[model samples]
Target chain A: MEQRKATIRTACVEALPLAIAIAAYGLSYGVLATQVDFNALTAVLMSVLVFSGSAQLVAVAMLAGGAGLTSVLLTVVLLNLRNLLYGAALADGLGPAKKWTSLLAFGITDEPFVLASSRFQKVGPDPLYFAVVAGIFYIAWIFSSLTGALIGDHLDPQKFGLDLAFPVTFAALLVPGLKGKPVIGTALAAVLMALCLEWFKPGNELTIIITGLLAPLVGLFMHRRSDHG
Target chain B: MVNQWILIGVLAVATYVSRVLGLTVMAGRELNPAVRLYFNYVPTAIIVALIVKQIFIPSGGHLVLSLPVLAACLAGALAILLFKKFLPSVVAGVVVGLLVRYFL
Candidate 1:
């Protein structure tokens, strides 16, 4: 019990800044969802359960566009494909955790995952730590969404093009990580897929799925070829 | 309203399913070296794709030769060069973007 208390305390201290940044993003998302007419309950639920800002933003955009259910689902799934890699990489760290650890892992979004993964390596596996960080993020997201919903549609940011937050954030994230051909190639593949979808029959979400699946394959093939040479 | 709920449900399930699938495939095992190497670059690729689509091509229909967006990008680039912090650069970009929109 003392060990658990120590773990939780350590996790909270580390998770503080991440919780703030993530909460800010969630608050912005809540504001946007409310402006788009999503009820407070729906908005809060999505943030708490979906817990993926990129996927949720894409889903909301498609919803505003009157996109079909199939399109929305596909877009979200494609956007979240990276979580697959995140989950896999994190699996080893979770090896010593209890069976109930999966519940905490469910809340492992980008920020917490990075922070938790880094700390988990140094401290050894601790489910309580993961739980503490995930819980903080989950609560922040839900409350922010709830707050946004209650504020109603009075503060619409779309007119100012604030709807571009996702893309902007993604852009900022992208500029730093392009170190090699593998990264460059996958980005090119995604761009090509999006362009083709936009210009041609408009595959909507399938474009994301296709690109998400293919980009990694391209990276794998390039790595193999480079190895052979 | 109901549609929003539906979208929420679909997105939640889709996100969860992908996570579950990933966890299962890598369950109780170390990641393949090849796979691990590629995973290192996925975040960069995803973010780049997102930014290109968002900042460069705001309107879905066409890529406008956007001076304001370009200016904002430059400002953001400078912020990054100076501070080396992601949020500061982004905030700089957004503030510059808003200014550009308001003035020009």
Candidate 2:
């Protein structure tokens, strides 16, 4: 029991920083949802149900851009392909939870994936830790969206630099993980692939998915070559 | 709009299925080592792509660098490397980005 407490406490402390960054995006999502004519209830409800930062934000942004439902769904599907990878990798860590795995799977997005994977790596499986981290992020996302919706169109997101939070938050999460040659090679490859995709057809929706699928091969090759050498 | 709600519902279900499928299907199985390594590397690849996507915006069919976004991302990356903290790094990045946006 004492060990469980320590695990939960550690999870919370680790999850807190990313949760703040998630909240910043949540607030922006709420405000954007409203701009796209989503009622405050719907805005908050979307956060309640979906709990995904990228999908929710992109859904609203595409709607605001006058994208149709089919297009939005297709794009969201592309964005969500990574979740399968996250879920698969997280499956073992969450296996002991049994029925609870379904409940925990909701937290299988990027930040939780990072936090949970690290914890699992360090201490082995601990569903309690995953639960704590997911719970904190869930509360942060839901409430922040509500706050942003209630604040409504009166405030400007850009003026306060809410827009910058997305990339900056990602950068903060990403930089810590850039360890070793293979990983650095993978990131650099991803950058090049993304830039090339964007250059070819600017704002291409497939850039992330394609880059994600392809870039790591470069890292794999580099890893193999270094091993042989 | 009713359309928005329907879209939300579709998205919620689709997203949940994607999230749950992997956990359930792969839970007990031991994956191939190479596959496991690839999965481990996937997040970094996706994140780098995401950051890059934001920093470069296409305008009139040409790629242009958004200096503020690029600067902010660099500042945030540097801050995190220095402090090993999340919130402060984000704040530093956003503040620098905002200054660039307003002053430039």
Candidate 3:
């Protein structure tokens, strides 16, 4: 029992920083979702139900850009591909959760994955630790979304530059991880490809999905070359 | 509104399936390394794409480069790179963006 308490404490301490980051982004997501016409209820509920930050943020951004349901769904699927990798990676640590893995599966996004993977490596199959970290993130996400949405509701999007918040917030989220040859190459490729697509046909619905599917191949190619060289 | 709910429902279902599939069925097996790398790169690619899409907004059937958005993004990226802080970087970005939108 004492050991379990120690694990929970450690998880809270470790997850706290990432949980704060999650809340910041969730607040941004909440604000952004409202700009796209999500009421506070729906915005927070999405956080409650979806619990995938990247997918949620990107979906709201795309909707603001006039993306339709099919387009947004396709783009979100592209974003969620990493969750497959995260789930596979975390399968072992969450093993003891058994049937409850279904509930735990909802938290299989990026931050929790990083924290839980490291925790499992150190402590070995601590489902409680994963739960603790995910719980903190979940609480942070839900409440932050509601708060941001409430704030967003009262504001004028253009006057306050709320529209620009989408990309700027994304920059804050994405820039730190811009490490390594392949990742850098992928981002550069995405930028160029998206520009070309928009130039060819501005506001094309397929631009995001196509660029998303194509740019990663550039990264994959870079990864392959690095391996050979 | 209805579409919003539908989008949420679909996203919830698809997201869960991707996760649960990996956990339940693909648990013991190692996915192809290339496939794994591709998935890892997807978020970066899509995020960059989203940023690009916003920076170049379509207006009147022509691409309009929104300087405020681009500058704010650059400022935010710089803040994160320099301080490694989340909320402050976001604030920096929004402040810079607001200034750009008003003055430039």
Q: Model 1: per-residue lDDT, tens digit, A1-229? A: 9888888888899888877777666666776676567877878888877998767755664554445788667656656666777777667666677676566668656776787788768977766777788888888777866775676456556455455444444455555665577777777776776566544543243444455556666777777887888
What does candidate 3's lDDT look like per residue over A1-229, in tens digits?
Answer: 9998998899889989888888888889999999989999989889988988888998898888888988888988888887778888899999999888888987788888999998889878988888888899999999999999999999998888888788998898889889999999999999999999999999999989999999999999999999999
Give the range where candidate 2 chain B is weakest over 10 consecutive residues by summed lDDT.
B31-40
| Most accurate candidate by DockQ | 3
* Pick by TM-score: 2 or 3, better one: 3
DockQ order of candidates, top first: 3, 2, 1
Error of 2 at A113 (Å): 6.0
Please state the error at residue A222 of candidate 1 in Å. 5.0
True contacts kept of each: 0.37, 0.71, 0.76
Candidate 1 lDDT for residue A43: 84
Q: Indicate the worst ten consecutive residues by lDDT in candidate 1 chain B.
A: B49-58
Preferred candidate (DockQ higher): 2 or 3: 3
Best TM-score goes to which candidate?
A: 3
Candidate 3 ranges with C-alpha deviation above 4 Å: none
Question: What is the Cα-based lDDT of residue B29 in candidate 2?
Answer: 70
Candidate number with the higher TM-score (1 or 2): 1
Best by lDDT: 3
lDDT of 2 by residue, A1-229 (tens): 8988888889888989888988877876776677777778999999988999878876775565355777667657766766877888788888899898889998889888888899899988888898999999999999999987887556576677766766776787789889988889999999999999999989877776687778778778778888889
User: Which is better, 1 or 3, measured by DockQ?
Assistant: 3
